[model samples]
Target: MVQLGSRAGAPGRHVVLCAEQISKSFAGVRALHNVDFDLRHGEVHALMGENGAGKSTLMKILAGVHTSYDGSIQVEGQAASFSGVRDAEEAGIAIIHQELNLVPELSVAANIFLGREPLIGGVLIDRRSMIRAAERLLARLGVTIPPETRISGLRVGEQQLVEIAKALSLNARILIMDEPTSALSSSECDTLFKIVRQLASEGVAIIYTSHRIEEVLELADRVTVLRDGRRVVTAPIGELSRGAIISAMVGREITANESGKTAQDGAVVLSVRNLTLDTLGPHGWRRTLHGVSFELRRGEILGIGGLLGSGRTEILESIFGVSRGWRDGNIAIDGAPVDINSPADAYRLGVALVSEDRKERGLHLGASICDNVALPSIGVLSRFGLRSFASERALAADMVKRLSVRCSGIGQDVAALSGGNQQKVVIGKWLGTEPRILLLDEPTRGIDIGAKQEIYRLIFDLAAQGLGIIVVTSEMPELLLLSDRILVMCEGRQTGILARENATQEQVMRLAAPGMAAWSQVSAS
Candidate 1:
């Protein structure tokens, strides 16, 4: 490593990177405005903001992903400009995006060294050398995944670590990370923290961005908050509190726990009985869900909690009629039996699902916001087999304003929007379908604190309007705060259901955990 400035823990070190008067715009909409940022060697500088707050736009400029920004960049106190990602990489700068970028069929080594694999005699690829190099990098970072393992074989957490390893393999001096731990579990997040600290200690300047407040408090050396495409505040991490960060990000005194849930004992809206789902795998037929039964009442928020592969997502997807290995299910709406063979069937019955993988299962990124939001309701908004563009635009415009989705216009592609904004579009699209029952899976998975509060408020408001909502989340606090009742699942089984007044995090986790003692007791009960 090329040592620079003082070692870790030494304040006032040598400046590694700086940006001045950075501004960017897209199609007449300013995404970033006069943003200035600087980073020192061996420091973790957290970029804080809600989605569409211009944090990503600023970082994209730094990483050479957006080269048209009006700004001046300095590296080692010398003016520099990058033409593309290649220029950024050559300048010792690299970024790991929140969305994992890897080919699933390839081995870990291949993904780590993609586009620049080692070669023998400057011709054929050197697979052996690449694997060895990848192994060395992973081992140095304390990651234990085998280099020969296919990327698809690893869990999401492991995949994240691989991304980190790939960035480090480039010997990047300035590392930009966006929402690096969003998909990780608690233990996995701890592991990532260790790796981050280790990298910082090695004199790497890390520009970290995340919606997680506690993480910023624990990991950041300095914090720069952006709001509405402008720099709001820049302060040392020690001088800021979680509440202060939240207040700065959203310009409001919104508490971290902004749950406004009240008493919910309305009539039953949806009911299920002995819903079993099966799938065929390499090992032949296997049950992904077994004898699951639950009831969702009108105006009730039902939270489902479980570990990965605990069949939490499977339950919601099965109900929406969109999941493999889904069969032998009995479903009813308002005490009337229903047959749903597909998502179309589910939609016709006034059921809407906001799927977990937004990229793959939810929104149409390449399409305009108007099209994506009006997708489910196109039939109703059409005349003589042609869409009424006026009504489509009106519906999208109304939902966008109602959801507070930050966008240039309804004509802009959904892909151009930020993650939170994209999520809001997904929800808005389903609302256009006019569903009585809403199923949300990991609804706020990667959204920031401010966006989360807004979403929670939306959920509360939707439930208040007598919509039955079922939410599946890995975050326990979200489960506890939003749900009128919580259901814990463990290994394809419905372990337990607890009322909001009596449900505890410990109790819910015990039931969600597969081998816990409470699992057997809850299943029996």
Candidate 2:
């Protein structure tokens, strides 16, 4: 049994909210058991757990999304029962979900004040007042997005900031943020941390949930870890180490191991020379990639590392024939030049891409696991121009078993699974195509530590089987861990490539930094 730490060093702050004996179930599945949690005024309490460990369920209950849960909630020493989100808002509570909940077609100001808009004469909406209020909230967060800009026009990090601004607009006493920084850059994360500190200082109690342990350690005053739907431990941040937190979250020690056999001398599988892509943005055709060149050897992992909008993802998109831009490059697969104009052409040439945004671009959320996994192989599985259910089921079952996807069999809807499992389903769908080269973009984003380790092992295993892989990731540790060689990018240009043994975080960052003349010369393997 792990000894829990006492909440010390803070004496005057009283409990602002509490949940006693909270338990929830969904479709005969026990999502959470009897769990006790509380938040103090001016505290950043972090909730940590693996995927499907009941963290989201608990947060939803507190946010009034799930009103059927068995629990007793107290707000400032008064028993409170919230029937809906409006009731929770009336109680001065607001929650930002892990998934962005804003409408894409709506403007930034419209999304910020979605349901509750300012009215002129208590009848018509005052667009000017709403925009002004939205601007103030964005200004408080140090964001400069225009109030009238459509949500679809913003990047993922910007969208996340908009979500934060939306939560702040409620002026709630209690705020819950679920995986808020999953899509943010380092600088964006720093800005968010400053805002979180400021909010806590203003006596706003916050319940923060994230899979990033370092962020939790830096920002959280106390941590409550849940495992298998039960509270594992609640301890002050000062009393716990990284190892302790991992152990509490996964019930074991996590060991770091090499991904797979280092195959530096292997045969070249794919080669790109002077790759350039130009996309038609709001400002007309803009160059996104310029003179990017690299070679991927069979059984080697090449990592693309850069800051946001640095053309890291664009490289993968171009190679996989999915870039919505004009491409100018020399691509050779197995020493033969090839032209890939569409995803089908890329697939025919033994190439597969797992997109960064799995929910939006990778998987069909409304479909079942079998349907999603079998989608990429429908042509192969069809007989006499008709779909074969037996073949699809067999393929789905095999992939599910190989990937260790936890679900109610392959018939379960993809939306019902946890983040880690949904990612597996996406990978499985691409693997069903039997591609020789795999391109992964931010594959472990929003997933827990345990799931990330599993993905790392899988990537290594695939590489060991002589499959070439190109991975684009924002995580420094993941880039260092999985890449045999790291390709650093800056402003759509290739900075340099560092060998695995020689690549350090500092070296990668130096090359990744824009306008760094010292390492501007690109190096190829």
Superposition error at 458 for model 2 (Å) = 0.4
Query: lDDT per residue, candidate 1, 179-220, as tens digits?
Result: 988766554566677777878888889999988888888888
Considering every candidate listed, which one attains the maximal lDDT?
2
Candidate 2, position 31, lDDT: 91
Q: Model 2: per-residue lDDT, tens digit, 1-525?
A: 112222343324899999999999998989999999999988889999999899999999999999998879999999989899999999999999989898999999999999899999999999999999999999887778899999997777789899999999999999999999998866678778888887887788999999999999988989999999999999889989999999999999999866675677889999999999999865579999988989999999999998878888899989988888789989999999999889999999999999888998999999999999999999999999999999999999999999999998999999998899999999999999999999999999999999999899889989988899999988888999999999998889988998888889998888888775245566644
Alpha-carbon runs more than 4 Å astray in model 2: 1-12, 517-519
TM-score of each: 0.86, 0.94
lDDT of 1 at 113: 95
Regions of candidate 1 where Cα sits further than 4 Å from its true position: 1-12, 27-30, 77-79, 104-108, 128-162, 256-264, 278-287, 326-329, 384-386, 406-409, 491-493, 510-514, 521-525
Per-residue lDDT of 400 in model 1: 95
